[model samples]
Target chain A: MRDRIIEIIGTHGKNQGALIPVLKAVQRMNPRQYIPQEASQLVARIMGLRESEVYEVVSFYGEFSETPRAEHVIKICDSTVCRVNHHRELVDILEHTLGIRVGEASRDGKFFLEYSPCFGACDVAPALRIDDKVYGNLDRDKLEAILEAYRR
Target chain B: MKKNVALITENFHHYIPPDLAGYKHFGGFTALKKALALSEEDLIERIEDSGLRGRGGAAYPTGKKMRQSKAYQDDIKYLICNADEGEPGTFKDRDLLEQDPFGVLEGMVITAYAVGATHGILYLREEYAHLLELLQGAMAAMRREGLLGQGILGTALDFDMTIFSGAGAYICGEGTSLIESMEGRPGRPRNKPPYTKAQGLYLKPTLVSNVETFSAITAIVKHPQGVFTGYGTQKSPGTKLISLCGNVNNPGTYEVPFGLTLEEIITELGHGVAGDKGIKFVQVGGISGPLLPRACLKMPLTYEDFDAEGLSIGSGAVLVVDEDTDILDFLDAVAAFFKHESCGKCTPCREGNRQLMNILKRMREGTALPSDPENIQRIAHTMKYASFCGLGKTAPTALLSAIKYCPEEIFMRRGQ
Candidate 1:
């Protein structure tokens, strides 16, 4: 996680094309890790691009993170129509099985969760993401099984 | 656990009428039936007293706009329902327009009567064509039953609604931009102060409300003088509809009270993270919202929650950035999008976003000076100060917020 962040910081100083590649390289390391603050300015000087360009790229998308996250973060899709699709049931099952509520980390620090407005997966109706994996049509049983992976 | 909040699904599994017969069976328009009994001015007063705000991204007071438009000079006032779901992480309005069309229609018609608008328009996003069609069919159904167009249920309120779809432009979601688009102009935003109440759409007085905001008014119509005993906190009441997605066992839409904490929302509503890999951080309230560390999840999901986190409660967007995920590239993608979308209306936003992207690129490619952090901060601050519209002003929010949270990773030296 740390190495990738460093590598990306190196790329932000290159030409314009290097911006995305550097970022992608860092993302490959770990979405949860903090990106070094100097990466943007370095990128601008190297690529002959403006610092604002780097800022825009970093801020516009939902995937980037600038800090370290908890051991587990849960995001539930709660779009207006998703409410009708039983997103509540998913939240309820996960919350109950884990014995914790949304946005709350488990007592043992095994889990953390919250509601997400959208993940761009509407066809599945009710779907989920475990780390980077997407799981659809999940119930309490599936949810529990999924959580078991992190028990290690 | 919080005494159970109602998650009224506008576009979930099913909440609308298959036919007029079905609508009446389900209590559709009962609010209108009750609201039609009062004078338009009286209806406005009730809404004002209710202290309701628009559900769109702006969160402006609904009744205040209605009251102001009441005195505009022209009789040709317009009531535009902004069903344009342009925001990337937001799809709430489409849910209401597609599933619970009547709920939104009842509210819009009543609003039309109150604001003295003869014409109503639903400015929808092109991506939601299927939803738009569903709404059109509902409108035709409403007209067939005499519920719309010149008097209904023996009342004398005359209003007509039409759907005008917008081409792809996220900026159009802005109220003034929507007005400009509706009037056959470029979808760029105008300066505030004159506001939509004083001059909107065809240069006449106009009142614009989002799809969900208008639908809530239907609930208001039913209650009229009735009051909601207890619900959300003082500033924001009633249940809020949210689309939850990303890194959870259950990723979909649900409703909860206003002050729900991020922790409670995910654990209770979203279940736990899908995989045990662990959650490192969260981006609540979408792109314009703040990027939060796991530490802040315990706070309530209200305006206060955002303020405490140094973030904004934007458009009800809540996203999760799971463990072992890359923060730089994700930021890179966001930067690229802004570079493409910046209207270039102002030099600061136009040039600032571009320069930031360049700097980010150089950093990613290992080509910038050691002082990249200071440069990034200087430009980000400039964009915040000089951008003309919310699009520009808030564009750097996520990046800056993330930087504040994780300056080490963002500023890490490669050779070290």
Candidate 2:
């Protein structure tokens, strides 16, 4: 892990502007999908910056998480377009299917459901993003089928 | 009479993914070739004559902005394409990149030549992560064809581009805030005076424009003079790509000339409200844009017309709301968005959003005092005048417009 982090930093260089991309690459490589305390400290030392600065960057953006996240993060659209299209019902179905409320990972560590601002998928209202793929115009069956595929 | 005008979107359906040959077959890089032959001053003047404005809400003259950057004497000036299309109810940029990536790239190269910029960066949002491979392939193809990197098409110009992904911050759509985020800090807006053209990315003379704006430049340079300006009204020339969403029956991206009324856009283009529902009101532009009642639909979709009614054609997102949805419920969603997306840098925005959300919540619960509406107005005005950035200043746009346009529907719910 240490060597990999160093290699990532080397590829992007030790510039301050390269911090976000480096951290993103590090977090994506982690098994738990988060930047652990040790990784942040190591990044700080190598980049010649304070540990707090690294942690602040991690905590500030919605994408980065310090603690462990589920293997797949389910981000439901909660903006005006989706809400007008009744995204609340989508949230209800998501919470019931996953058997965990929003902001919580499933007991088996498979899924974590949360809300995201509109991601320019408004054409298909009531959309959700799992990993990099976006699914929209959802109903109960479609939602269940999507989660089933991810669960497998 | 024509519902769709295909200028930037002319070859949208023809090209396959990353098909450089197909893009050329449809007359793609010919504009760059023509632009390369002209002096920088002539190119800028032609763009100015076309009357093309910034497509990303502000509507500043694109040619004027390019001329301003050209005045500065910098060895390493940067041209940053703001692809951070985080605006709610907007997906036109995503469509353009997906269908016509080469047009956008061609525009970037032409703009770089005009401004004498060596480095170009496409600030893509994280949500559009799926398009990364396609863009990379397109750039690689451009390089192979001598369209990008070190002496483009046997010219002395040398320019290159790279993609930088934003980590989900709507405020980063602001020019300075986007630059700040690129600098690896928290995505917060900086004080303006040395605007982005003077001192931008890495404190250099950088020119930041939206993805659609770059594509428009490509279109303007492609055709003969007065041909591109033939569409739309006298003040606002050329076509606009509108992301029509919400309760519209046919919700999608449409490229329309600027003279059509909102009613025509909603009815003829969008196929009217979904499920045959009656119209309640429309939110022109994105979430930050003002909400207009049905009566205002008669106004044409021009910058001058919208400006006359104290509204701007921001982002070209026309979000139609049906009569089935309540106005206050809609405002709640709008309030929640600002509260969540605020960078919390300044007091007026950070605290003002919290207060606005609280008051909206109380009003929804029917627990408001008579002073609540007045208080909401006061807080909104304060945030408008005092907030540090565009996010805070325009945060209360929807709420204030609700009060102004739909006062009876909103205050009646309070039984006042």
Question: Which candidate has the highest TM-score of all?
Answer: 2
Encode model 1's per-residue lDDT on B211-234: one tens digit a residue.
878877887666535343145777
Q: Per-residue lDDT of A83-123 in model 2, one digit per residue for the tens?
A: 88889999999888878998899999988888999999999
For candidate 2, please provide the TM-score of chain A on its own.
Answer: 0.94
TM-score of 1: 0.72
Candidate 1, A71-148: lDDT as tens digits = 565667554224434567898888888898876777776566755443444435466555445565667777777788
Residue B416 deviation, candidate 1, in Å? 5.9
lDDT of 1 at B142: 90
What candidate 2 gets wrong by more than 4 Å, as runs, is: B414-416
**Ten contiguous residues minimizing lDDT sum, candidate 2 chain B:** B407-416
Per residue, candidate 2 scores C-alpha lDDT tens digits across B1-416 of: 57788998998989895999999999989999999999999999988999999999999999999999999878899999899998899999999999999999999999999999989999999899889999999999999999999999999999999999888899999999999889988899988879889999998999999999999999999988887789999998889999999999899999999899999999998999999998999998999988899999999999998888888889999999999998888999899999999999999999999999999888888887789989998999999999999899999999999889988877777544
Query: Pick by DockQ: which candidate is best?
Result: 2
Q: State each candidate's clash count.
A: 126, 0
